[model samples]
Target: MQTEHSFTLVVAYVDDLLVTSSDSTVITILKTALNSAFTITDLGALKYFLGIEVSRSDFVQQLSQFLSEPRAPHWSAAVHVLRYLKGTINFGLFYPANSGLSLEAFSDADWGTCIDSTRSLTGYCVFMGNSLISWKTQK
Candidate 1:
């Protein structure tokens, strides 16, 4: 943590730590302190965490739909997904301070797209000005 205007956020899960702050020097100091006390590793930038790839936008939510029960018809789609996933390996979200704080959201559902069921997939995307703030896809 720094002064009231500048603060650092650290998320610790088990032994791993994800640290972020507006100032890079603060992050460096925090990491050095943690390493001296706990012998921590600096993994540089965050890539993969838990089971999530930690990149891209709402594409994973759509991908989850096919995982439930993949059929032969979705094979080509799967291949395309592999390519798309590869391209997004370096993707990350960035929201500038100048971006206004206007909260807007939109959602839609694909009614009965499941080949073997009547269920639908619904998804919503929330945006703050030009930055994407939240998104999810669910069945």
Candidate 2:
């Protein structure tokens, strides 16, 4: 079932429901209504969902991949990511309350970056206000 309130929007998939809102009261009310209709357990704040780790602050939200298994180069890459996170534990995207809502993106490609396949390396990041909401790198 799908439900939308003035402050909250809920989308359900099978037994999973994703609720989003700017106000916690709206979310609580929705969850209560849903509980009355069906048996549900509130997981509280979202920390880990699927294979992604989510962290949030007053100004920004951050997401990172949670590795379950890694071998060779993948292990090394995962270690590097962990090191970066450790070093930047206190760092977060800066988005002031007065920041604009404009979205901006920057992308670039390095031709023939892959020595074996001659594939180009492409990377991009999208920012809403001063917070990076999306980023990707591919070859």
Candidate 3:
């Protein structure tokens, strides 16, 4: 583990290594250290991880699009996902232990985000006692 960037975070039952900062330089340095300590498999960027399509938000409504792709076929996706998990085995989403306890959910729809189908995509998420338990978005 690198003294500079080695860290751990937990999201639900998943474990993730929280790299220091979002800076490319820091991430590079950390990746180097990680490679030295163990076999390294780079999934490139923080695009899709563990079935979740991550989108960074700037405000409550305005969300910046990062990347999104159709869910992989269950059978084949497992191998790829597993390899990704192994590579990022130490990384996870971290919620403060002292954070407030609550359960909430939100739903939204896009008029028509699917160019091929000309159909709208709808998505909703359920938070179990505050942490996201289930979510799905599809056209």
Best candidate (score: lDDT)? 1
Per-model root-mean-square deviation over C-alphas = 14.0, 12.9, 16.6
Task: Flag regions of model 3 displaced more than 4 Å.
Answer: 1-85, 128-131
lDDT of each: 0.79, 0.73, 0.61
Cα lDDT of model 2 by residue, 32-127, tens digit: 998999899998887755323587764222222324544576667657768988999998767688877788989999999689899999999988
lDDT (C-alpha) at residue 67 in model 2: 40
Stretches > 4 Å off in candidate 2: 1-6, 60-139
Better TM-score candidate (2, 3): 2
Residue lDDT tens for model 1, 3-37: 87688888878877788886788898888888788
Worst 10 residues of 2 by lDDT: 58-67
What is the Å distance of residue 119 in model 2 from its true position? 32
User: How well is each residue in 1-139 modelled by candidate 3, as lDDT tens digits?
Assistant: 2346444332323445535343456678767997899786776656555444666555322211212333445435556656877999897656567755576789999987678888999999976455675689988
Q: How many clashing residue pairs are found in candidate 3?
A: 6
- What ranking emerges by TM-score with the best candidate at the front? 1, 2, 3
TM-score of each model, in listed order: 0.38, 0.37, 0.34
> Whose lDDT is higher: candidate 1's or candidate 2's?
1
Off by over 4 Å in 1: 56-139
